[model samples]
Target: MSPFAKLLLVYDGSAEAQAALERCAQLSLALSAQVDVISVVDAESANAHCAGLLSDLAFHRLEELARSTLDHAVRQLTGDGIVASGYVSFGRLNDVVLRHTQAFNPDLVVVGHRAQARRSRWWGSRSAHHELTERLGGTTIVTVTLPGT
Candidate 1:
């Protein structure tokens, strides 16, 4: 078995994420890893923003979108000859990713680097790389960027 037998990849369907996915697909092939691609929806944000009457509906819609995105990612990876599966979950990205990391025990976690335009994320804007590094403990996190991005 390859050293990287279990690989976890985060995908948000953005162009940046697509670039990460492509690199992940290549790595999975070369390393013969089992890839788990997760698409996350921030339930905290959903509950905070979609309040009152439409909260439940908004949350449901967000969850459905997450599932759809995961499915598309899985299909793409499968077509790329990578053994992969898709998962959808709701929570803060860091928490959700860490939760899965604890469970999946992946050899490595791969993520796309966010653009500068998204530096104003909720909670004062931070890099996913930083969050994962802080919360993931011993897990290895790899950040991928599109060429010329």
Candidate 2:
């Protein structure tokens, strides 16, 4: 083991994402690790035809939402006596996440796994979280299971 001191937490603002943030807080406390919370904006989807007109203001709003989500996660961790740093990026979710992991070089990555319907699974409904985890290389990634499953 390389003495894990940094934790990278990925949040999507979902209930499962919140649970992952809570788990990150607890783990940070237990391991005395510094946490970097991240949110990846799916810009590809935002540019889709059905996404409506996305102006500069819309992108700004998305940035604001990402910051707010990261802020909330940081607050929760700090409230629990775990100090952490936060970051947000806008791009393809998987690419954004991978770039962040490479840049930050965290020891562990945390994410939430959304349950997929059978049909969806067969249709390749894998989430960005799972993709990022697989691409994390040497970093250990933890997937927080969905609640009530």
Alpha carbon lDDT at 33, candidate 1: 92
Per-residue lDDT tens digits for candidate 2, residues 56-143, read 7877887888888888888888888886888888788778778887888888889887788899889988876667757777778888
Score residue 146 of candidate 1 by CA lDDT: 78
How would you encode candidate 1's per-residue C-alpha lDDT over 19-134 as one tens digit per residue?
A: 88988988899899989999999978666675634466777888898888888889999998888988887789989899999888999999999655654764487777887899
**RMSD in order of candidates:** 2.4, 2.0
Clashes found in each candidate (C-alpha, N, C closer than 3 A): 0, 0
The number of clashing residue pairs in model 1 is 0
Task: Specify the highest-TM-score model's number.
Answer: 2
Quality of model 2 by C-alpha lDDT: 0.82
User: Best candidate per lDDT, number?
Assistant: 1
Q: Estimate each model's TM-score.
A: 0.88, 0.89
Q: Distance (Å) between predicted and true CA of 93, model 1?
A: 0.5
